[model samples]
Target chain A: MSGVEFVPLSLTPLLIGVFSAVACALPGNFLLLRRQALIGDAISHVVLPGIVVAFLVTGVVTAWPTMIGAALASLVAVVMIEAVRRLGRIEPGAAMGLTFTAMFAGGVLLLEQSDTSGVHLDVEHALYGNLEALIWLDAVGWESLLDPVALAGLPDELLRIALTLVAVGVFLWVCWRPLKLSTFDEAFAQTLGMRTSWIGLALVVVAAIAAVAAFDAVGSIIVIAMFICPPAAARLMTNRLEIQITWSVVFAVLSAVLGYILAGYGPLWLGLDNAVSAAGMIATVSGLILAACALWAPCRMRSGAPAQ
Target chain B: MTVELISDQGIAPDARHPEESPLAIRGMTVSYGQKPVVFSVDMTVQEGSMTAIIGPNGAGKSTLLKAALGIVTPLAGQAKVFGKPLRSQRHRIAYVPQRASVDWDFPTRVIDVVLMGLYRELGLLRRVRKTHLDKATSCLERVGMADFADRQIGQLSGGQQQRVFLARALAQGADLYLLDEPFAGVDAATEKAIIAVLKGLRADGKTVVAVHHDLATVHEYFDRVFLINTRKVAEGSVAEAFTPDALDRAYGGRLATAQMDRAAS
Candidate 1:
């Protein structure tokens, strides 16, 4: 176990999971705050066309254009939602449903128009992830830590993940009061001279960036699970905004690690030929955790309550 | 001007010009989609007066207030506050929306809500300091909620929640306040407390416009009333605006049989 040859095969997925948890949790807390959980679903699906278009134009998969294209696509999604709001006077959820379905359909059309190979759209790799295979890539590297037993290797995407998480965390920390008030009572927020539109736009931007980061790691399907489930679970446990955010981060990180380990060992343990995808497994666990948390929260609240 | 008009009906005080008007809306129209909710309405809220915009449901009372706050775009007319456009005079106005409009489950405290009232004054990118926090505490204290400053807003009762909103508005320290149905669903104690706070605002020479539904309480609560039914029916002292004629016009056939004794008295 001390030698490099004895390094855990689950290390790569575990790292990916940890990073995904932290990245999604920050914006997930905000999305939960705004009651715009569906926006995560919208951004995840909408980014497909952006990535596809970028690939078609650039003839290569680069991070800059991919992220930018995804951001633009997310903006388009917001505009579409606003247009539906203005024209149809429909509820926001309905608008989100209409826009995402159309954008996702457009993405499918783009993929068809480009005639990308059957292997190109690889749902298996995209939805579930191929973390074990990625450990050999140019970006993932191992760093020697102070402790000989505990070695920390920095991956290529680590900086982006770390910086995004830190920046978002600090941004929310600084704007916590405004965000809290704005999310709670937008009308009152407006009266306070806070620019509601700008705050709304900032939230959208945060959602888009978080979605983009998760897009490359686990693809669209898992991003929603990471973005919504943890915060929702956190919401059940706490009423304080700061505590909820903190709990969400903790839950996400735990789910990621648990999901990664489960996916790695399930094949050997259960005699399954194809183990579940790491992202799918993590998302499933998160959903289960949220459901369990929801069911038990009321009981706990009742038990703790004094005689009224 | 000194003579009171009296007929077989009753004595009517001469409608003297108010010392000042804080808000005025002229020929205002608001539409949702193609259909109009407020049509060619004209209203004026006097300075230092607690005015209530009253009508039955869907009478566009809230819409009129939104127009005054510049929250809703008017299709035809303009709303001026303190002799200036609402956007330019944003700092002078404070708003308290109905408590139902916000998610109580949101993770925020009473103090946090109150501090937000100072955001416009504090400007963007500037961190909130001890002074802002102190102001928030004082505002909460004014609402008699300073003890619950650290309590989550969700944990409070409906009346307490309403008081938190009032505290947030009070923290704004604005010259004008537009509250949308602040008394609805509130307990009697909370209602009296709110009225006291409104009177305090009036005493400070500020203007208040509330969208109210309780016909029984309107006269007792407001000095001025704007009777609205898509369009302005009348605007004057509560005694003048709460007449049988205005009630008939505002409520149509409904007011003929369904009379609250308070409306007549």
Candidate 2:
């Protein structure tokens, strides 16, 4: 294969994977620090029902309805989790597990009931993302980069991932301090008039947005993995919040690029003609990075580091 | 002017002139879940004095401080700082919640924790300036944690951790300070150093209120004592409120603290 042939073919999937990974990884750091990493998992599971309901009503798969449905469903999941936690007086982990799995099952059943003749919503696509389907065939030359016709013909999934990344970046840029304070010392932050409760809800909403944006291209498995693995790996590498965030983004980008190549090429080297799921490969690579960082990151190697 | 209107309503005394007192609590009732922890308490902390809130276990000493700081919601009453709500006077009041309330193993250096006091000064989207960084260092020096500023919080001893919390509060530079059990589990030397810092705050004309556990040192370290058992049993200078009668009222007639006070005297 020539450079020209491979460049246009691989560019869209790689960009989509990188942006999707970063979007989920950025907010995942705070969740990990807060010991609310499971909430990210629950949000990913719960948002499925919302998207399905939205598709059922709208009769089409569109970004606005999917986002709105996902956001609302995640909100309901959070509220139900809290209610279970408070009323049953159970541990938060148990509450989250119960609420999300039930909601996800309900969503899957509801999806089963909807007419499937014309719709693309299916259990297989939801479980394993269709990474190979997102191909931008419109780029005839460099003119396609700026031309409106070529741009319109490009895959919408990539745009969704890019906009989600931008949203995550803006959230970090603006609410960094309040988020940090509330995560570390919520009571003191409340005394400082930071409204820690509001900050907490904002965090959940942002996490939901990230999870939902990455859901279509990466599936819930990779979306949940992206929301946790890279940030956790970065956490092992540094003590500063700013540095941890930077390393997480870097790790995510690396996982996206390396994981895609390894998935697409590793099979050929092993005498298998077909490539594997790129999303699954990316998640596996992120997990491997986290495991490596856990063992050898400088901060983890220090004396009496308490073994994270 | 002679009448105290906060007797029954427990509303802050003289709400119109709350500024006359450093901190005011009126008709403050608080609950934990469904159970009431504090009920109908009222008191005004004198300006420029170190006041200790002394009570037996489960007497809501910490809860009262948290309620005043709005860290915990009050069921019926309100607390005021300089005649305004906590949010309005947030920058003017520094609060130290119980040390155990936070995750000490949080992944950040100690200097950053102390620098959190200057966060309100930064407002939204403003970075920490050199002047604020200098002030954070000075505040750490005051609490004797300057050498450990770069270390992680979990690396420190309990007393050192308490001192770091004090340093963070000091960096706030507020007129009113509310500390929840600042001396809990601290070494004698750390306790002495904290007293020196609290006394220094008084000398600087800042009001200091702490949830204190040591009855023997209450009179020696504080200018006033707020004795309570879910209610404000008594609140006045050590000469007036640190009586055996008040201690009996606050501690359900268990006089170990009163006996200890006598032995020390």
Candidate 3:
């Protein structure tokens, strides 16, 4: 592919995909270890209602209001799940399943009833985001990389996701010790005077932020996939948290790049006319990675048990 | 403060100072939903002594420890450590939750779990220095798990996992150590090593309180015993509290005949 075609069409969307994937996958390592991987799926699913509610309230499609709405929805989902689990004496998985699916159904209902025909708000757009439409139309070639005007014209989604990724990275770096300790043993962390419950809330909040940001750019499919698949696959490859995290990041980037390429050009290479959804392809790629690791990774099975 | 005020009034001048005691609880009650697991119970542990909290299943032995440590919210009462609230004196306390409480398959090495005990010293952002590593290593050595320091936590046997937990507690170097069922599923050799370490802690003037299950070992292992069944049944030295009546009260009809005979003997 010539630099001209790639820089104008693929560059911005590819960067956005990578940034969103990494941001979501970073917190995912801890969440998977803590057995709360489904929280990511729940958060992403509930984001739909949040965005729709934001559109209804503001009477316009703007980034900040929608992002705030999504974040608030994620918080409400988390609290509801906790409340149901505690009050109903139900397990966490059931609580999460019930809450997220109900919220998602409400989101779809709202989308159908609202007058969003004039805008780019729909269930299909929310699920499989228009990654193809997020193009750098102002770019002429590879030289656009250093051009001031072209950089300024970069898609807003890329900048938003980049900032989100940086924020997630800083949170992880600052709270690495407490997060690790608490995720491993909540009671022990509490006994150490760590305010472990608050730490857990903060982690969930951070994850919600990542989910909302990534959901805006790459759609919920990539957000949910990146949140669990890479970290889970990473788990099977190593028995150390530090190494597992590194491997997850690597997997996230690999999925974004490879999945984007396959979605965009793989069909064309096979004499097909159009491309597939980047979000779907990325999720599929991540699942494949997880499956491959499950089958062959050294730490796939418990250390001492006989292999099935 | 009320105790001090009363003592100042020249009533019970020989009253014990709550601060002097390693742990002092007054009327602590914890409930799960409608059922109160631990009723209004008072307990005080002497400094430099090994105390066992023995009770039947669901008698709230673990709940009492958890409530006092502020891990589980109590519906009523206060817990004082060295005469102050638990939060303020948290640094002086070390807790080893049950081995089953955590996911053993977590991806971490034994040394890292021990290093968690130094969390307060390391705080949130400070680099773990050589001194921290040395402290963690020495604690692991104390539990005879120094060689397993580099091993994955999940790879160890149940007894070895218990020892790693003990080592983590030892890393804290706290004045009071609280352990919940430290020997519930350990090999006899591991049990001996753990008891020796606990004895060594008591000898060093540190207080040790454990939720003990084995009625027979109470006499040999602990100098003090606090028996409970939803409420405090008995509390004193083993000679005073480890009686057939107290055992029967705590365990109810659930106490085995062989266990009762061992307690009586």
How close is chain B to the truth by TM-score, in each candidate? 0.88, 0.89, 0.91
The regions of model 3 sitting more than 4 angstroms off are: A304-308, B1-15, B257-265
Candidate with the greatest TM-score versus the true structure? 3
Q: Give per-residue CA lDDT, model 1, range B1-265, as digits (tens).
A: 1122223245332223321246777789999878888999977666677888888778898888887676677899987776666777888888898778777767666787888788776655677799999998988887788899887776787888889889988988888899999987777888899999999888777888899877777778889888888988888888777898898899898764445633543
Q: What CAPRI grade goes to candidate 1? A: acceptable
Q: Model 2, range B160-223, lDDT digits (tens) per residue?
A: 8888899899989999999999987777788888889989998888889999877878768998
Whole-model lDDT, model 2: 0.85
> How many steric overlaps are in each model, in order?
1, 2, 0
What is the C-alpha lDDT profile of model 3 across A183-263, one tens digit per residue? 999999988888887888899999999999988888899999999999999999999999999999999999999999999
Error of 1 at B223 (Å): 1.9
lDDT (C-alpha) at residue B250 in model 1 = 92
Alpha-carbon TM-score of each model against the true structure: 0.85, 0.92, 0.95
- Indicate which candidate wins on lDDT: 3
| Model 3, C-alpha of A282: deviation from truth (Å) | 0.8
Clashing pairs in 2: B10-B26, B10-B27
Task: Please give the TM-score that candidate 2 achieves against the real structure.
Answer: 0.92
Best by DockQ: 3
